[model samples]
Structure formats: C-alpha cells, structure tokens
Target: MNRKATALDVAKRAGVSRSAVSLVLNGRGDGNVAKESQDRIRLAAQELNYSPNAIALSLRNQRSRIIGILSDEVVVSPFDGNIIGGADDVARSRGFVTVVMDTERDTARDASAIETLLDRQVDGLMYVTVGLKPFEVPQGMLRVPSILANCYDEHPEPQLHHVIPDEVKGGREATEHLLQLGHEDIALLAGAAESPAAPLRVQGYREAHVAAGFEAREDRIFMAGWDIDAGFHGAMKLLDDVSPANRPTAIMCANDRLAIGVALAAGRLGLSIPADLSVMGYDDETRIADTMVPALTTMALPLREIGRAAMTTLLDSIEGNTAEAETTVETMVPCRLVVRESTGPAPTR
Candidate 1:
C-alpha cells in the first residue's frame, strides 16, 4: 500500500510552508494566511488525501476531540439507535469522534461506565436513554461538559442540560387530529405512569379536549402498560359487549404496539377499521408502524433530533461557543405527526 500523505506533502504540493499548511488546515487561516494560499492548501490536501493526525492535534490543542456517550440500552436495542446515529453525524461533521458504552438499562452500572469514559479524556459527554424518562444525574458527568438525550436529570435542581421531545404536544396533536375528524368520544390507552412520557401525553390529551370546548371523560383514560396485551385488554373493556352508540368513535394509543392490540381487538369484534372505529398510535416505530396491515397513523418521537441537539449543546459548551449564564438547562424537540391508513373521520352517529 502507498504511504499515507502528511502535512509536509500537502505543504509541498500547495507551494506553501509547513506552518502555513498547518494554520490553514486547522481553521486559523483567516487573517494570518492569504486567502489564495488557504484555498491552494485545502485543494492540495484534498488531492493528496492528507489528513491531520488526531493524536498530535489533540496534544497540541489540549483537547481530545472525542465525545463520550453513555447509553442505557440505546446501542444494543433496536428501538432508539437512530439517536446515536444522529449524534455521530453531528460529531463527525464538527471534527470530533464519539465512543459509546451501553449499560442495557442497568442504572447500577452508570457510574462505572461514566468513569470509564472520563478516563479516556473525552472533551465532552452525552447520556442517551432508550426512552424519555428522568434519572439521577451521574456524578462523574458533572466533572465534564455533559448533556442528556431523551432523558433528563431527576434532581430538584438539575445540574446538566437535557434534550427531550415535546411529548405533551405530540399527545395533544394526536387527540386534536381525532377531534378534527369529528370524534369527541375518544378513548386513550395511555402508558403506565412510571414512564414520564405517559403522563405528559395524557395531560396533552386533556388539554386538547379542554381547548376544543369539552371536558374529557376521566373514566375513558386507561393507564395501560406499554405492550400489545395491555392495549388488547384495554380495548376489550371499552368495546366488547358495549353498545355501538356508547362505544368511542376513536381510540388513541400511547404507542404503536398498543395500537396493534387495539386493531386486533377491533378485528375480533368484526369491526371494520375507520368505518367502525378510528385508531391512532404514537412513536411511529421503524417497520412496525409503516408495515402494519392498515399502516398506523401516529405521532412520531423525534429521536434523532433529540440526539443531534444534545450533542450540539454539549459541543457548544466544550468549545465555549455558548454563554453559560444564558444557556437554558432543557431543550425540547417537537414530535412529528405521520398520517396513515389507521385513522379516519368519526362515523356519523
């Protein structure tokens, strides 16, 4: 194999001194080096495929240019891998690399994992979770600039910055979509209260009803678990043996799996979707949502966006690009609505 190109090769090709090549390639070329020389140096480096040595650069700049990521099963689980993909994209574009460690949702391993990342001399850190929830901030994270993605600090006075999706808005929008379709008697299969996202979404559901000039029926909201069985049971209790006139025209699930259960229940009851009842789901999961028989109409969690925002925030703090005093401790990304075959207008009474 041919030897790798170096700064010296780029300098000779660009007809500039080694110091000039270093200055231009390192982004300090503006006033010190002529614009023409900077352009030539970049073109020569590109042609020569010459890249800076990360180790040497780190030593000279006193920055590792590495971001450490602490994940609670995000790396191993298929559910939220896009968060890390998005974070890596931003990190790579900013001339930084990322190292990820998965704890598989084991909170007990958090401190050790964080300590390991810190030992690697990372310039910054990010903690990502598979879902939206609050956790006790790892004390090791406090030693460096850190951010949280799809999770937040549970402390009364939060220390680290967090980026999360606007779950309440997502819940409200799902309800509003059903309401706009002329469904007033909407049933909610909200996730269990243990997950922070559930209550916020439930709150949004109520907010939508209130804004639409109606009071939501408290009895209709079921704090179901986040699984197909919970959804099936919840729907059965709502629809089985219930008179058509009394049954809800639309059912909104906290997740797509629950929506699947609702659909299964509807099928068993010999009810045609949309024509007999409308269903909505959340999370817009990878293949599950789009490939469903009737394709789920759902609110999508902004997983990738949350990751990108968290990394950006962490990097800004590391590079002194953000004003610490003015920086907010939380960043909330908005969830998106994907319309599909699963939802429709309420049946005419």
Candidate 2:
C-alpha cells in the first residue's frame, strides 16, 4: 500500500523546513516566506499529492466547515433536486461541505434530525421544505446561524433569513400570458383552497384581469387538488355547462400537473388545444412540461436559485456579514415564464 505523503516529505523535496511548509500551506506565510520558496513548496506538495488533514485543520479553527441541511422531505424529488444541487455547488465553492437530513415531513423526527446535525458540529443550518409554507423553527436552531428555504415562519426572528418563491407573481404571469393572446374569457383551475400557494395564485389571476381592464368571472375559478384529476374535473365543469359562445377560450392551471389534466380532458372532448382553447400552467415541472403533446406554457419556480440564496444568506449570517441587530430577513425569488407550444392566440368566436 502506498503511504500518504506528508508535509515533512514536501518540505524535504522543496529544500524547506516543515514549519515553512506548514506556514505556506496554511496561508500564513504571506509577507513572511519568500515568493520563490512558497512556489517551490506548492510544486513539491503537488508532486507528492500531499493533502492537508481536514479534521486537524477544522479542530484548529474551531469550525467544522460543514453546513447542515434539515429538510421536511427529501430534496431529491423531480421538482426539488435542484435545491440540493444549488446548495451543494455553492458550499463547495466556499470551501465548505454539506450534510443533509430528511425529516420525511414527520414532526416526530424533527428533533432527532436536528440533534444529529448539531452533534456533528455543523457551522450553520438550513431548514428547507419541498413546498412553500410556514414551519416552526426546530428547537436549538436559533442558537446557531440558521436560515429557511422554500418556507418561512409566521413570526420570524429578526436575524432569521427566508428564501421562497414569489407565487403571486408566477400566478399573475401565467394569467397575463393567456390574456396577451387575446383571451378575454379565461378560466382558472386552482389548487386546494387551503394551500398557501392557492390563494396567492388566485390573487394573481384576479390581478391580471383587473390590469387588463376587466374582472375575472368568479364562477369560472374552480378550487381543487393540485393534480391531473382535479384539473380534468374542473375543466369539464367549466366546459360542460356553458354554451360555446359563453365558454372560456383559455384555462390557467395552478400547476403543470393540473394543466396536463385539463389537456387530457380537452382531448377526450375533441377540443384541439389553442385551436378550440388555450391552456397555461405554473410550476414548470421540467420533466413533464416540455414533453407534453403540445408541450406546456408555464411559470418556472427558481428552485435551485432559492437554494443558492438560502445557503448564501446562512453563510453570511455565520460570517457576521449581516446586520447584527436585524430581526428578520425575507428573500423572495422570482419565477421565470417558459413559453411553449401549449398556449396560443384565442381563436375568433
């Protein structure tokens, strides 16, 4: 077995003392060690494949250089993996590593998950959720530099930072897109009324109509589950009762899944998308949105960006870069509009 190279070996190869190698490698040799000597030490270390002892370095600094991520659910879902990727990418670039623990959305496991991370002596913590909602801060989180991602607290601590999507804007954008296509009579297939995202999106839908100098038909807005079945049922309800002259020309679904449901229902009814009716959706759902029959026009949540921002905020707090006396911080990330083949100009009645 090949023995791991040591600073002593690097120093001998560079013709410098071990102390000199240590100073150079630890970034404390600047202004003390000669530039040529530093260069020689680096070259020797590279040749020997010498690596620093991370544990020893961490102990010396009194920091683990590891960030702990405690999430309500696995961040590896098709709609959420980007959050983990984003956080990991930023942490690596900043010379830190991440440890993730999923609570499986079980409140009973939250305490245990937090304790496990704390035991590891993580430098900071990030409490994340797969969806946007309010969550209670785990006990002891306030004792450490912590941040919230894709979630917030009802009564946030002044220093606590939150990163979340702008649901209202996303909803409005989806509606506005359909309106721009000259669809004056629009229907909304929204999510469950109790969902936080549902009301915000509904507000956006109404705001779009108001901006266009019209009021949305209250009867045309249907609240249901955030699924294809709900969308199908809602779309049928809107189309089945109304005469062709009074029916909506466009439908704005709260999510891509719901929009897919609408599309399926429309197909069964022999309605050609955008020819007989137009459809728009939110939460881009990358895997499903672009692969649909006519594809999908939707608003994309900046999931990865939200993760990056949350990690950045937590690091800033840990480094004392934020205002010391600040009580709370809320960071709203905007969603982007992805135009696809599912939406088009309203057909002339």
Candidate 3:
C-alpha cells in the first residue's frame, strides 16, 4: 500500500528544511525564505500531493471552519431545498463546510440537534424555515454566531440576526398589479392566520387599495390555509353565495396553490381566467405556476437569496465583523413580481 505523503517528503523533494516548507505554505515566508526556495517547496508539495492537516490547523487557529444549519422541515420539501443549496454554495466558496440537520418542526428535537452541532465544534449556526413563521430562537444556539433564514423570532434577543422575505411588498405588488389592470373589486384568499406572512400580506393588500383610492371591502377577504383546498373552498364562498353583481373581478391568492384552486373554481363556474375574472398568486412556485393552463401571475419570494444572506451574516458575526451594537439585526429581501398570463384587464360588465 502506498503511504500518504508528508511535509517531510515535500521538504526532501524540494531540498529545503521542513520548517522552511511549513513557513512558505503557512504564508509567513515572504521575507523569511528566499523566493526561489518558496517556489520549489510549492512545486514539491503539489507533486507529492501533500496537504496541511485540517484538524491540527483548526486546533491551532481555534476555528472549526464548519457552519451548522438547523431547519424546520426544509430538508424534506422540494420547493424549499433552495435554502440549503444557497447556504451550502456560499459556505463552500468561503472555504467552509456545512453540517445540516432537520428538526422536523419539533421543538423537542431542537436542543438535541443544536447540542450535536455544538459538539462538532461548528464555528457558526444558521436556522432556516420552510415557510415564513415566527419562531423562538433556541437558547442553546446563542452560544455560537447564528442567523435565521425565512423566519424571525417573535421576541428576539439582541444577539439574533435574521434574513426574511419582505412579504408586505410582495403582497402590495400583487394587488397593485391587479389594480393597474382596472380591477377595483378584488377578493383576497389569505393564508393561515398564524403565519407571519399572513398579516404582513394583508397589510400590503390594504396599502395597495388605499393607494389606489379605493376602500377594500372587508367581506371580500377570506382567511384560509396555504393550500389548494383552502383556496377552492374560499373561492366557492366568494363566487357561489354572492350574486354576479357582487362577485369580484379579480382574486389575489396568498400562494400559487390557492391561485390554482381559484382557477379551478372559476372554471367550474363557467368563467374564463382574465376574461371573466383575473387571478394572481404569491410565491411563484415555479414548478406549478408557469405550467398552469393560463400560467399564474404571482410574486416570487427570494428564498435562495435569503438563505445566502443569512449565511453571510452568520459568517460576519463569527469573524467579529458585525458593527451593530445590539444583539439582534434584521434583514429583509424583497420579492419580485412575475407577470404571466393569468392576470389581465378587468372584464367589462
């Protein structure tokens, strides 16, 4: 069996002292070692396939160079996987590795997951969420430089850093687009009331109406789950019980799934999308949104960007580069409006 090459092998091949090779490789040889000797050492190390011991180097530097990620069910969701991908990409580019764990949204498992990552000597931590929700920053996580992604702490400590989507702007943009198309009578199919995204979106919806010089009808808004079923049911209530004169000209769904449901409901009622009624959704849900029959016009949340920003913040904190005097800092990434075929000019009665 071939033995692994050592620093001594590199030094021997370069005809230099082992210490000289070490100094050159560790970036301290500029003035101490002759330029010719440093070049020889580098070439010899490459030829010998010799590399420094990461463990020993880390011990000496007091840094593990590993970032720990804890998520609440993000690992299992196809749509949410971008968060992990983004974080991993940035960590790798910065010469760090990532260790990921999914807590499955079980608070009971958070402590153990965090403890295990801590035991691994991770230099920093990132807490990610599959959806926008208010969470409690785990107490144990405070031991390391940490950041939250796509989620925020309801009552944050000064040390917490968060990167989340600007749902309010996204909501307003979606509604404003419909309004610009001459639709003043619009219905909102909102997501779960408990979700942090829900209220922010509602606020934006109201803001858009106010800006357009129209008072949104309170009865036109329906709160429901962030799913196709809730959207279907909500649409039924909005379209079935109301007379045609009272029916909204457009429906703004909190998510693509709900928008799809509204489309289906519209079809059942013999209404053509954008011709009889326009529909808009949030969270472009690329996989579904663009493929729908009419294609959904929606707001695209910058999920992957949020993940990357969170990692960047955590790395800054780990390196003592943050300038904030407070313990917590919040950052919001804005969503973009994705125009598609589902939305159009309001139908003339």
Candidate 4:
C-alpha cells in the first residue's frame, strides 16, 4: 500500500520547519508565521495531499467529533430527513460528523439505539419521536444536552430543549386562508387519534371559525387518517352524506397526501376544484403538491425550519455550558399558507 504524506514531508517540500507547517495548517499561527510562508505550506500540503489524522486530532481534542442521532419514524415518513440535514449542515461547518440509528418506532428499539450511540462515544445525542406520546428519554441521557425537533413532547417536565411546529397556529392559519377566499363551510379531515397534532389542529380549525363568528359545524369535522386513502374515503363520505347547502364549500385535509385524495374524490364526483369545491392541505410535501392538476393550496409546516432549529440547539448544547442547566425551551416557528389554483371565491347558487 502507498504511504500517506506526513507533516515532515510537507515541511521538506515547502523548505520550512515542521512547526511552521503545523501552525499554518491548523490555523493557530501567530504573527511570527509570515503569510508567504503560510501560502508555501498550504501549497505543499495540497501538492503532497497531506491529510491530517482525524483520530489523532480527536484524541488531542478530547472529542469524538461525531453527533449521534436517534429517530422514531424514518421508515414511514421523511420528516427525520429535514432534522438530519439541518443538523448535518451545522455539523460540517464545525468539523463534526454524524451517526444515525433508527428506532423503528418502538420504544425498546429507541433505548437500544441510544445505547449504541453512547457506546460509540458520541459527543452528544439527539432522540426524535413522531408524536406527543410521553416518550421516556433514553435512560442516563439526562446528562447530555438533547433537543427534539418538528414533533410534539412526550415529557411533561421536559428537561431538554424541544422544537416543533405550532400546530394550532398552523391549523388556524389554514382555515383563515379558506375563509379569506369567502369559504364559511370549511371542513377538517384530521389525522388519526395517534397524531398528537390532530387535536391541536382541530382546535385551530374551531378557533378560526369562531373568529369568523360562524359556529363550526360538528358534522363537518372528520377525524381521518393522514394517508391519501383515508382522505379519499373521508371526502367521499363527507361529500355524499351532507345536504347541498350544508356541504363544505372548502375542505382542509390534514396533510398534502390527504388533500390530494380529497381532490381525487372530488374529481370522481365531477366536482370542479375552486368552482365546485376548494381544498386545502398541510405539511406541503412538494412531491404531491406541485403535480396536482390545479396544484395544491396548502399550509407549510416548516419542516426544514424545524430541522434547522434543532441543529442549532444541539450544537449549542454540545459546545456551550448552557447544556448543564435544567432549562426547558419550546420554540414554535411560524407557518404560512400558499394559495394556488385550488382556492377561489365561494361558488354562488
């Protein structure tokens, strides 16, 4: 095997002292190291392809330079992608790397994953679950500064930092958008009860209607699943069972998939989008939203932003003394509605 280049080789090629090469490459040089000398060292290092030993550096720095990640739902949903990407971006800038293990949505698996990350000697760790169900933190992780992003809290006392979308705000904003387009009879096709987001979203729907001084119709509120199939069936029942006057002028499906399902069902009934019925959605998953016939007018849940915030919090906790405090934080990033061809002025009889 070919041998790797070392600092001594770099110094020899640059005609400089090994100390000079080390100081310039490590960015720890004082004024005694001339800019011209530094340039020569860099050029030599590049020419020889002298790579620093990360393991040796880690030992010297007393760090693994690796951030460990645990996710509850990376199989069925891509939400964890945003969190990981956000964290990775920050980690790279700080010369850190990441390691991840999926918990497969099981609590036992979650605990085991944490243990694995711990065994790997990660500088810090993050554990993420999809809902508000009180998840027990990986035992003994109380000593690490951890943060949760884009999901609700399981821990009531919440000893660590948490970042999540403001579901109530997201829900109310979605409803208000429909109302702005002159929709009074708006319906909520919600997610399953397992979704902690469901009840908060329902609350937002109600608050919006109340703000408009229109009593929200209980019949119009449907607790459905988050999938397209659920929306398909729910929209059918809502459309078929209600009186013409009582039928929803607009519908807010829980997520983009559900909204697309609503559109498909409405289309099957020969109902014109925006003219016969308007539909709105949440999560704003672009894969489905951008391709819809009229395109989807949906509420964006700030998934990427959730990832960004969680990363910032994790880095801070990893590098700062703040991690040692008993502080608990809840940050609700803003959400907005994107109006597309799907919504319009209410149809007149």
Candidate 5:
C-alpha cells in the first residue's frame, strides 16, 4: 500500500519547515509566512494529492453536523416523505446530517423521543406530526431547539417555530375548482373529524360554498381516515344514499390516498370519472395520482421545504435568535393545484 503523504512530506518536498507548511496549508499563514513558501506548499500538496480529513475538522469544532428529527407518525401520506426530503436537502447543503425517529402517533412517546435527541446533543431538532394534534414538548427542557412540521403545539403562547401546508387554502382551492366546473352540490370526504386540519379545511370549503350562494350542506360532508380504504367506504356510503342519476357531481377528498378509494368505489358503482362525477384530492402523492385509472387531480405541498425550514428554524431558535414574533413568521407554505384527468366540468350541462 502507498503511504499517505503528510504535512511533513509536503514541507520537505517544498524545501520549507513543517510549521511553515502547516500555517500556509491551513490558510492561517497570511503575513506570517513568506508568499513564495506558501505557493511552494500548495504546489507540493497538489503533487502529493494531499487532502484534509473532514472528521478531524468536525472533531475540532465539537460538531457532529447531525440534527435530530422527532415524529409521532411514520407516514401521513406521500407528502410526509416530501417534507422530510426537502429539509434534508437544505440541511445537507449546510453541512449537517439528520436522524429521524417516530413514536407511532403517540404524544407521550413523541415527547420521549425528543428528550432522547436532547440527550444525544444534536445541533437542532425537528418535530413532525402526521395529523393535527399537538405533540407536547417538555415545558422544562427549553434548551432543545425544535421546529414543527405538519402539526402545531397549539401553545396559547409562542413556544416553537412551525412549518406546515396551508390546509385551509388548499381546501378552498380544490372546492373552487369543482365549483368553477358548475358543481355546487359538492361533497367533502375529509380526514379524521377531530383533526385541526379537518376543521380549517372545512371552513375553506364553507367559504367557497358561501361565495357561490350555496348553503354548504352538512349532509354532504363525510369524515374518513386518510387512507384509500376509508375513502372507498365513505364513497360507498354516499353511493348507497342516492341514485346515480341524482347524486352530487363532485367529491373533494382530503388527500390523494382517499381520492383513490373514492375512484375505486365510483367504479364499483359503474360511474365513469368526469362524466358522472368530477373528483379532486389534496397532498398529491405521485404513486396514487399518476398510477390511477385516470390520473388524480390534486394539490401539491412543499413537504421537503417544510422539513428544511423546520431544521433551519429550530437551529436558529436554539442559537437564541427566536423566530419572528408569534405572528410574523408563518412557516406555513401554501399548496398548489395540479389539474389532471381525474377532475373536469360537472356532468350537468
């Protein structure tokens, strides 16, 4: 095996003292070492293919360059990975690494995982939730900097910086699309009824109905889990209620997974998409949206960006620079509409 070249070798080859070579190579020799000697050291290093050890550099700075991510849910949806992916991109670019853990959606376990990260002395922490329930943080452990993703703590006062999709806006936009296509009697296939996200999105749908002089009928809204099976069952219930001839022309599902179920249920009822009913979903998951019989029309969330923002903001807060006051720093990013074959003008003229 070839011996790795050291600073001493470079110095000897350059006809200079090892100390002089060290100073010049480290970029700390400015005005202290001769310019000619600096140039010689650089050339010697290049010829010897010398490279500094990154692990040693990190050790010197007392940094592992790793951040910790605490979560209560593993996969909320395809968007779940997206948010975390976005955060990873930002963190890696900044020379940081991330370690993620989940507590299976339990608040107590979520808090415990966070405490573990603190014990590990991570540079920063990101707390993520799949649903709307607030994952409690330790009131006493204020030293750990944490940013929230896809969930909020609902603190009566400002306690953490958070980044999540603007569900209300996404809900309104999906409903408005259906309404624009002349679907006034649209149904909302929502996630869990108690989800904070659910209520906000329902409000947006209400706003759209109100704008069109529609009553936003209570009977039209159905609550279901964020899964294809849930949507399928919920759609079946709606299918059982009315004859296909008189049923609502559109369904706005809470997320893509649910929308898939809706489509499957409609098929079982012998209904053709966009001909008998127009369907839309949120949190566009590629596997569900692109692979469906008719590609699903849905909304896109910047999940990855939310992840990155969580990492960065938490780091900032941990460093003692609190995020902008309680109101100004809204890390919530809005969702974008992704029109596809799944949605279209209502069956009605």
Candidate 6:
C-alpha cells in the first residue's frame, strides 16, 4: 500500500510551510495564518487525504480533544438518540472526538459514570436526557467545560448552560394547526405529569385556544401516561358512548406512541381518520408516525439541533471562545410541525 500522506506533503502541495500546516489544522491559524493560505492548505489536505495525527497533537496541546457525553438511556432507547448523533457530527467536524457513557436511566450511576469520564481526561462533558426534564447537575460536570441537552439544571441557582426544544411552542403550534383546520373542539392527551415537557405542552395547547378566542376545556385535558395504552383509553373516554356532536373534532397526543393508541380506538369506533376525526402527535418518532395507517401529523422535537447546540457550547467554553462559559444560560431550539394525512379540515357537523 502507498504510505500515508503527511502534513509535510500537504504543505508542499499547498505551497505553505509545515508549521503553517500545523497551525491551520489545529485551528490556531485564524489570525496567525493568512485566510487565503488556510484555504489552500485545507484543499490540499483534502486532495491528498492527509489528516493530522490526533494522539501527537493532543499531547502537544495538553488536551485530549475528546468530548465525553453522558446520557440517560439514549443508547438503549430509540427515542432521542439523534441528539448524540448531532453532537458527534459537530465534534468530528471540529477535529475532536466524542466518548459516550449511558446510565440507562439509573440516576445513581451518574456520578460514577462522570468520574470515569473525568479520569479519562476528556476535554469537556455533555449530559443528554431522553426527554426534557431537570436534574441536579452532576458535581463533576462543573469541574470541566460542560453543557446539557434536552435537560436542565435543577439547582436553585443553575450552574450550566442547557439546550432544549421549545416544547411550549411545539404544543401551541400543534393546537393551532387543528384550530386553523376548523377543529374548535379539541381533546388533549397530555403526557405524564412527571415529565417536565408534559405541562409545557399543555400550556401551549391552552395558549393556542386563548389566542383563538376559544375556551380550553379543562375536562377534556387528560394527564395521560406516555404510551399506546394511555392514548387508546383516553380517546375511548372522549369518543365512546358520546354523540358525534359531543365528541371532539380532533385529539392531540403528547407523543407518537399515544397517537397510535388513538388510532386503534378510532378504528374500533368505526371513525375514519381526518374524515371523521383528526389526530395529531408529538416527537414525529421514527417508523411509528410516518408509517401509521393514515400517517401522522405531529410536532417534531429538534433533537439533533439540541445536541449540536449543546456540543458547540461545550467546545466553545473549552477553547475559551466564549465568556458565558461560567454563566448560566439557556438555549431553546424550535420544534417543527410535520403535516401528514392524519390531519385535515374538521368534518362538517
């Protein structure tokens, strides 16, 4: 096989010095090296397929260039794994690496996992949760440049930056979508009260109603668990033994699993989707939402965006690029509305 290309080869090809190659590749070239030469070095490296030796570079900079990610069940669960994927994407692009440790929802193991990562000399840390909630920031996390994704610090005076989806806006937009489609009477299957995201979504649902000059009926909102069964049962209470005029024109669920349950209930009741009753879901889960019988219209969490934003913040702090590294700040990424066949104009009474 041909010998691997080196920085010297790249420098020669780009007509720059090897030291310039080192500076540019290590991200210290902005002011030290001319922009035009930086471009040439990068292009030459690409053409020659030359990459810097990560181990040697790390030793020289006294940084491991490795980001450690702690997750609450992301590795084992299908939901919210994209958050890590997004974080890794940014890390790789910036010449850094990511190492992840999953607690599998075991809060007791968090401290130990963090200690393990710290022992490994990771440059920074990031904590990601499967859902939006608050947790006490692990003490070890404060010892390094770190950030949170899809979760927040529970401390009275928060100590870390966090990136999360705008769940309240997601819920409001979902309800508004139904209302704009002429669904004046809507039922909400809010997720469990334990999840911080549940109540925020409910608040959004109510806000949309108030904005539309409609009263959000408390009786129609169920703090149902996040599952197919909860969705089915909640929907039955709304549609079963109720007259068409008395039934809600649309049912909004806190998650796609719940939406699946709603569909099952609708099928048993001989109600056709969108024609008789509209259905909406949140999270836009993989395989479930888009593959439902009529497909699903839902609000999508910005999982990847949250991850990317969180990683970017952590790296910025580690590299001394931001002064807010020591300050408490929150970043909220907006959720997207994905329209599908499950939602349409309300049926004429």
Regions more than 4 Å wrong, model 5: 1-63, 75-79, 240-245, 318-329
Model 4's alpha-carbon lDDT is 0.78
Q: Highest TM-score: which candidate?
A: 6
Where model 2 places Cα greater than 4 Å from the true spot, the runs are 1-53, 156-159, 323-328
Model 1 TM-score on a 0 to 1 scale = 0.88
Clashing pairs in 1: none
How far residue 18's Cα lies from its native spot in candidate 6, in Å, is 5.8
Error of 4 at 59 (Å): 3.7
Question: What is the per-residue lDDT of model 1 for residues 256-306, given as tens digits with 9 covering 90 to 100?
Answer: 999999999999999888889999999999999999978899999988888
Q: How accurate is candidate 3 locally (lDDT)?
A: 0.86
User: Against the true structure, what is each candidate's TM-score?
Assistant: 0.88, 0.83, 0.83, 0.80, 0.77, 0.92
Please give the RMSD to the true structure for each candidate, in Å.
3.8, 5.5, 6.3, 5.9, 7.4, 2.3
Q: Model 3 over residues 1-349: C-alpha lDDT tens digits?
A: 9999998999999999999987777545667799999999889988988877767767876999899999999987767778888888887645578999998778899989999999999998888988887778778788988888987877834457788999999889999999999998999998998887888999999999999999988888878888898888888888886777789999999999999899999988888998989999998796799999899999998988888888877776776556667555789899999999999999887
Q: Is candidate 1 or candidate 4 better by lDDT?
A: 1
Sorting all predicted structures by TM-score, with the top scorer first, yields: 6, 1, 2, 3, 4, 5
Best by lDDT: 6
Q: What digit string (tens of lDDT, one per residue) describes model 2 on residues 1-349?
A: 9999999999999999998988777655666689999999989988998866877967887889899998888554556767877888877655578999887778888888888899999999998888788888777687788888888876744446789999988888888898999999999888888788889999989999999999889988888789898999888887776778988999988889999999998998888997888888888897798999899988898999998998877876665556668665789999999999988999898
- lDDT, model 4, position 234: 90
Candidate ranking (lDDT, best to worst): 6, 1, 3, 2, 4, 5
Candidate 2: C-alpha RMSD after superposition: 5.5
Candidate 6 residue lDDT tens string, 210-302 = 999999999989999999999999999999999999999999999999999999999999999989999999999999999998999999999
Model 3 poorest ten-residue lDDT run = 319-328
Off by over 4 Å in 6: 1-3, 8-24, 27-43, 323-328
In model 4, the worst 10-residue window by lDDT is: 319-328
Looking at model 6, which ten-residue stretch has the lowest summed lDDT? 319-328
